[model samples]
Target: MRGYKQPTVSVIGASGYSGAELTKILARHPSVKLDKLYAFSQAGKKTTDLYPWLAVDMTYEAYDGEFDSDICFLTLPHGEALKLVPDLRNAGKMVIDLSGDFRLKNAEEHLRFYGREKPDDACMTYAMPELFHEEIRNATAVSNPGCYATSIILGLAPLILKPQDSAKVNTVCCSGISGISGAGKTAKTELSFSEMNDNIRAYKVARHQHTPEILQTLGTSATEPSFGFTFTPMIAPLTRGIYTILNIALDKHLPVSEITELYRSFYISAPFVRVREMPPEILHVAHTNFCDIHVAESGKDGSVVVITAIDNLVKGAAGQAVQNMNIMLGYDEALGLT
Candidate 1:
C-alpha cells in the first residue's frame, strides 16, 4: 500500500438510513478516505448515537456551505438534495445523489411529482451500474435510482433490451412489497411498530413519486418500444429489503428456460445481479448489495413474469451509490462491495 493515494469523501445527510448505510460502506472502502460526516439537524451527535452498531467514532457536523472533499454523497430527501448537488458539482466535487431530484430529466415532471421546482443547473447521469455503467463511469454527478425503480427496472431490463414491436407490447404491472425501512428513519404514526406489525398496506397507489422514474428508464432502455407500466408500492412488516413482481406482456413468447437464460446473459458481467431458478426472497439479499431475479412464463399468451428482490437500503440506495463511486474512481466494481 506504499505510495498509494485515496480520494477524500463525505456524506451530507449522515443521520438518515441511506446516509448511515453509505457512511458504513465508505468506512470500509479501501480506496476512499471518509473525511466529513454532515447532518442538517443531528449535527453534533456521534454516528453511534444514530447507528449503535457501527464501529466508527466520528461526530456529525452541521451542514454549513463548506465542504472540501474530493467526492460527496447527498443522501438527503427528494426536494432537499436539489439545493446542494449543483453547488457541489460547481465546486469541483464529484457528487452522487440518492434522491429523486435528479432522476427525472424533465423539470416539469419533477415538479409534477415531487411538488418542487427542479434544480436550476442539474446535469447528471442516472446511476444504475448494470445498465448505465459507461455513463456513470465518465460522469462527475450521478443520480442513484429509487428503491422500487431499482427492483422493477432490473427485472424488466432483459425483455426491454431486445427488439420488439412497439404496438404489440401491452401493459407492465408491478407490485412491490417493501420493508418498513423504505419509509426512512422518520417516525410516523402509521409506521409505528404497533401499527406496522402484521399489516400490509399500499400508500402511493397510481401516483408514487417513483412512477415516472421507472417509466423514464423503461422508455430509454428499449429501442422503439412503447411500454407503459403501473407501479404499486406496499409496506410489509419487516425492517429491510424489497420484493417486486413484474408482469410483462409482449407480442412474442419465449419459453421460461429461454427467458431465464436471457436474464442470466444480460447480467453476466454484472457483479451484483443474480439470476435464480426459483423466485427471489428478501432474506437472501437482506444485508448484501445483490439483486436476485427470477423469470417465468405464464398464461397461454406471451406473458413473462419477473420477480426480483433486493435490500432497499443497499442495492436500491447506498451500495449502488458506492458502486458508482467505484466506477467513477476507476476501481473494480465489486472492490469494497463484496
Candidate 2:
C-alpha cells in the first residue's frame, strides 16, 4: 500500500444489504479508499450502528450534493437512482448504479416491470462484466444487473445460437428462497424468524421486476437472438445466497457432455465464473463474488437445464458493482474482487 495511488470512493444508500457489502469490500480494497458513506435517513449515525458488523468505522451523512471522489456506487432503490446518477456523471464522477433504473434500453420497458416512469436521459450501459467488460471499461455510467438477472443471464449465455427475438427463446427460471438480508435491514413481520423458519413459498410468479432486465440483457446479446421466459422467485429459510434452476426449451438436444464443455469453454476467461462437473451449492459461493454454474439434461421435451448459485448481495449486486468500478478505472479486473 506504500506507493499505490488509491482512488477515492463513496457509497450512497450505505445502509442497505448491497451497500454494506460494498462498504466491506472497499474498506479492504488495495487501491481504493472509501471516503464517504451516505444514507438519507440515518444521517448522523455511525455506519457500524446500522450494520453492526462492518469493521470499517465511518459516519453516515445525508446527501447534500456531490461526493468528493472519483467514483460513486448507488445502491438505492429502483426509482431513486435515476434522480441522482445524471448529476453525478455530469460532475465528472463515474457512477455504478445497483438499481433497475437504467438497465432497460427503453423507458417503456422499465415502466412495465417497475410501474414507474423511467428516466428520460441517455441510456446507461449494462455492466455485467463477464458479458460486457469492454463497454463497462469505457462508459461513464453503468447499470448493474439484478441478482436474479445475473444468475439467469450467465446461466444461459453459452447456448444462444443467434440473436433471436424477445419472444423466441423459451425460458423458465425457478430461484430458491433468498435470505432475509436481501429484504434489507428493515423490520417486517413476514421476514421474522418464526414466519420464515422452515418455510419455502413462491412469490412474484411471472411478474417479477427482474424479468425484463434479464430479457433486455439476453435479448440484446449477439449470441442470443431473442428471449421469452417465466421467472418464479421463492423465499427459502436462509440468510444468504441464491440458487437458480433454469429450464430452457431448445430446437434440438445437445449432449450433456457437449453442453458442459461449451459452458466451460465460454467461461474460460471469466475468473469468477466456475464451470463445475456437478451442480453448485449456495454455501460454496455464500460470501464470495464467484458464480458457480452447472449444465445438465432435463426431462422436459427439447429443453436443457442450467443450475447457477451466487451470493445475492455479492456477485449479484455490490461485488459486481466494484468489479465494474475496477474496470472503468483501468485497474486489474480482479484487483479487489478476489
- The model with the greatest TM-score is 1
Off by over 4 Å in 1: 1-4, 119-121, 164-168, 220-225
Q: List the residue pairs that clash in candidate 2.
A: 162-225, 163-225, 164-225, 164-226, 165-226, 177-235, 177-236
TM-score of 2: 0.92
Q: Can you write out model 2's per-residue Cα lDDT over 217-297, one digit (the tens) per residue?
A: 765521232555667888888888888988877765556786788788888889899989888998999989999999867
For model 2, what is the alpha-carbon lDDT of residue 75?
Answer: 90
Q: Kindly provide the TM-score of model 1 when superposed on the true structure, using C-alpha atoms.
A: 0.94
On lDDT, the candidate that comes out on top is 1
Candidate 1, residue 212: Cα displacement in angstroms equals 0.9
Candidate 1, lDDT over the whole model: 0.85
Alpha carbon lDDT of residue 222, candidate 2? 18
Q: What is the TM-score of each candidate against the true structure?
A: 0.94, 0.92
Q: Tens digits of per-residue lDDT for model 1 on 70-115?
A: 8999988778887787678789888899988888876776777788
